[model samples]
Target chain A: MKSRKSLGDSEELKEINISPLIDMVFILLIFFIVTTVFVEEPGVEVQKPKAASIKDLEKNSILIAITAKGEIVFGGGQIGIGGIRPTVRRLCAQEKLPVILQVDESAPGALVVRAIDEAKLGKARAVFISANPI
Target chain B: MAIKRNFASSEDMTEINISPLIDMVFILLIFFIVTTVFVEEDGMEVSRPEPSAVQTMEKDSINFELRGTQVLMNGKNIGLGAVRAQVSRLIQGQDLPVIITVGEEASAGLLVRVIDESRLAGAKNVSLAGS
Candidate 1:
């Protein structure tokens, strides 16, 4: 942030008013904070994959937890391929359920893919694999 | 005395004006917004437990232990053809809250896929369990 001053007049120099600018900043900060809604992943604890280049998402929907030992759970509850569609449908109907798959480092790809497939089948619009930022 | 015209020039103003400060503030806001990183959690955790529990897998689940000719479902040894047939019928209309247990072993060949295929065959829920 840069500023300039008006000189040459000792008695009445023109000064730049900054109170409005500061006010604007505060408004924007508040707007971003208020508009952003945080979402928590459900089910068991999931250790996310690490990536050097990961971007932040503003909002997310449903969450799936994958343990390093290869156990998959969701919504604080465990379900299998048989139980996926109904749960997914229930979640998606409320909202488009932007799914995030939090996979453990040791978890295999086949399981992750299956979850994604189920979410899609349940009518979820988008599915993102959770990864830690670098 | 002429006062030497005072040494200060119009361009030599020492005090800074703050209009440009607003521009700088906006620039910073844009930078932060563009650089911020956000993340979403993965869906769920499905793990294979150690084999020692007395609890049994779901009666309707197509539990398979693939050791070439040693295919099993629901704790019974069966042929591949029969296993497939059972899976196709088991995952019909059920969804959510149901479970399909898969065993965990470094050498549990085809068990993972069998679990996946069972899901594809129509199982609503799939999980890995200790057999």
Candidate 2:
């Protein structure tokens, strides 16, 4: 009887408690879901030039791309230099933000300068030319 | 009475002390959630040049001409890889202005690369001339 009682107590102590583990797992899952953010890419792909003075950009800035073929892209749509002013103006009026020009390494220099000029005309708070760090 | 007492004690033992464990897990979860930073899109770093009211041509400026894929430093053809060394050699002791003259048909990428290389070579004031 003594041996049997000891065996029963050991059996109860050996039982695994998994409810707390389940709760922890669920909490971890919720934490990851809440923290995940979707990153959007510019539609066109261009090889950006390398620079030593590059810095990380702010999170809420607008992205503009000039492809190697000299096509201007804003918000995944093709736009001309003339389109830059109005688009930037509307967006900046809502919330003044930095405009990042992702110019292709082989695009025309004139197009890049033109884009910067138009962004200035649109009253963009700041204009940045994107480049990779060497 | 002994059997009844044993049964009651076993039932109490079956109840795991998990409140403190749950509290610790909750704290860890909260810490991870609060410290999490959403990853930003990967891209290059960008800098802004000051806008000038008048495009004044400065003296002692070195000209780099971009025609198609060929890069020219003062009308002499130089490869893209050689640009940094040559620029550093030229701008060693003085902050000579570096001007890049890009043709209308030249690639913008080449121009930016040249500008970056020049800056990396210690050229302080780099400007792009109108095509």
Candidate 3:
């Protein structure tokens, strides 16, 4: 009888209280949810030019990329020059967000100018060119 | 009697299972972790002149012509390294507007670097013009 009682107590003890673990997980989950900003990234990588005047831009702004082939890209897809105005207009409709142009070192200058013109026409709060700190 | 007591105890300890809730929470946590982008983008602002604000070019305004990969001033290739020096030498303690006329074949990177160099040289009102 004593052995059976001991066995029953051990079984009860084996059921570890997991409330603390759930609490920790809940905290972490809430933290991530609160801090998440769903900004679309320009998927392709480009070699950004180095500059001494580069400053930290807004993290929640729109990101557009110009490849070495002069292809205008946004959100992992080639949007072309025509897409800039519409995209910027739609995104900035709710709130005026800055537009950041990530141009490769070898991208053509004409495309950059056109892209800026379109973004300006779309009412971007400001247009910035991404660069590395020299 | 002991078996009856054990059965009664088991019946009395009815707790709601929360394993499913924990699983859902874990999935949400993982999703957020994977989606979070901690990218720190650094950049310089390009202040394009408004189309309605077009005015005659101010005299003594510094002009930089970007052609292919070369920087030019007055039809002479001042080269990339000489941009800051040239702008500062011409600026001479005034808020001289610097206009960059980007050529068709000029690279975007070189143009941005020239703008940055001009800014560093204390040229305040920098603007872009299409070539």
For each candidate in the order shown, give its overall lDDT on alpha carbons: 0.55, 0.73, 0.90
lDDT digits (tens) for residues B29-108 of candidate 2: 76667656563433433223334512443446667778888887667888789888988887887977777766777777
Candidate 1 docking class: incorrect
Task: List runs of model 1 lying over 4 Å from the truth.
Answer: A1-40, B1-131
Q: List, residue by residue over B1-131, the lDDT tens digit for candidate 1.
A: 34544544534777657668768777767765654436443222233322332144444344555443355655677754564467666656764222334333322224433443454466544554433
Individual DockQ of the candidates? 0.07, 0.26, 0.64
Model 3 TM-score is: 0.83
Question: Best-fitting candidate, measured by lDDT?
Answer: 3
lDDT of 3 by residue, A44-126 (tens): 99999899987899889999999999898999899899999999999999999999999999999978988999999999999
TM-score for chain B in model 3 = 0.74
Which candidate wins on DockQ? 3
Docking class of 3: medium
Q: Highest TM-score among the candidates is held by which one?
A: 3
Please give the lDDT score at residue A76 for candidate 3. 89
Task: Flag the better candidate by lDDT, 1 or 2.
Answer: 2
Runs of candidate 2 with Cα error greater than 4 angstroms are A1-41, A50-53, B1-60, B93-95
DockQ of 2: 0.26
The alpha-carbon lDDT assigned to residue B129 of candidate 1 equals 40
**In every candidate, what fraction of the native interface contacts is reproduced?**
0.08, 0.44, 0.90
